[model samples]
Target: MIRLMQHADIHSVFNIEQQVQSHPWSLKQFAEAVDSYQCTVIEQQGQLVGFCILQPVLDEANLLLMAVAPDQQGNGLGYQLLEHSIEQLPNQPVQIFLEVRESNTAAIRLYEKAGFHQIDVRKNYYPNPDGTREHAVIMVKACSDDFAALFSSP
Candidate 1:
């Protein structure tokens, strides 16, 4: 089941973030996002499987964070979470944007398959624990008539 994130889901979500992200969002950071952004979680058999965080402004929306438990990766949960979040946008957004770590090939493929295309790059954006830095690829998707149809059909 997918539902709005509640305070109680923070622990699980934070754990997944830590497991999947090299620079995980701290629990406090998650708290702030939960307080001000649109957050949702997907549960399977009472276990928190995945979650997505988004920020919408006017006709544009930004997907701030998305994660799936490490054990749950490759099962299509991330794609489902992303599409579900898009469907839950406060208003029908004409565009959605997000940045992905240049090294995260799986996520890049997922976003591309969802219709987002790389538009630009941010230099040395993500800090690595090993003192290295990674660039971020900015991706965008135009959610016009054909894109909106993704939600209405079936």
Candidate 2:
């Protein structure tokens, strides 16, 4: 089940981040996200499986972060989380955007499957351990006046 994240979930969320990414967000960063963004977590049997952080900018929504427990990958949890976040957006002609590390093919594929298109690329947008930088693929999906299409029968 997915639900709004609380202050207590930060520890687990940080642990998951450490396991899933080479460079994880600091506790302070997670705290700020919880305080400011639309943060949500997916839980199974009381264990967090995934989470997403989003921010609204004018008529656009930016997906600031998203992560799924390494063990939960390829199980459609990421897709479900993405869909849920999109559904929760305030009613507006909003354009949702997110950036994926260029090397993360699986995440890029999932974003494409969810109707997001590659809109641009951010050169050297991500850090590398060897003091180099990696690029990011910027993807976007426009929400219709009514987002029912996102959940309606196909």
Candidate 3:
């Protein structure tokens, strides 16, 4: 089951973020998402599987952060969480945008399967573990007039 994040899940979410990514969002960042934007988490048998953070600005929505437990990759949980986020957008002709590490093929594939297209690239947009920066692929998708079509039973 997927649901909105709660105050108690912050610690677990943070731990997952740290373990799965070289550069993870801090507690403060997650806190801000929980307090400001619409953040959702996916749970299976009560275990956290994945989560996505979304920020709505005008007619567009920004996907800020998304992470899946390392052990849960290739299980389609990321797609579910992402689709859920898209489902939550208001019913209007909105555009969705997100950035993925240029080297993250799995993420790029998932985003492309979900209807997002690579719009541009951002140079040195993400921090690397070796104290360097890496480029990111900027992707966007134009939604139908009714956002619900994106989430129809599939």
Q: Pick by TM-score: which candidate is best?
A: 1
100-131: candidate 3 lDDT, tens digit per residue: 99999999999999999998999999998899
lDDT tens digits, residue span 1-154, model 1: 8899988889999999988887788999888888888999999899999999999977789999998888899999899989999998778788999999999999999999999999999999999889999999999989887466766779
User: What RMSD, rounded to one decimal, does every model reach?
Assistant: 4.0, 4.3, 4.4
> Per-residue lDDT for 1-154 in model 2, tens only?
9888899999999999988888899999999999888899999887898999988777678988889999888999999998888788664435789998999999899889988999899999999989899999999987765465445737
The 10-residue segment with the lowest total lDDT in model 2 = 144-153
lDDT against the true structure, each candidate = 0.91, 0.87, 0.88
Q: Which residue pairs clash in candidate 2?
A: none
State the local distance difference test value for candidate 2: 0.87
Q: In angstroms, what RMSD does candidate 3 have relative to the true structure?
A: 4.4
Q: Model 2 off-target regions past 4 Å?
A: 146-154
- The list of candidate 3 runs beyond 4 A from truth reads 90-93, 147-154
User: Which candidate do you rate higher for TM-score, 1 or 3?
Assistant: 1
Best by lDDT: 1
Q: Give lDDT: candidate 3, residue 106.
A: 94
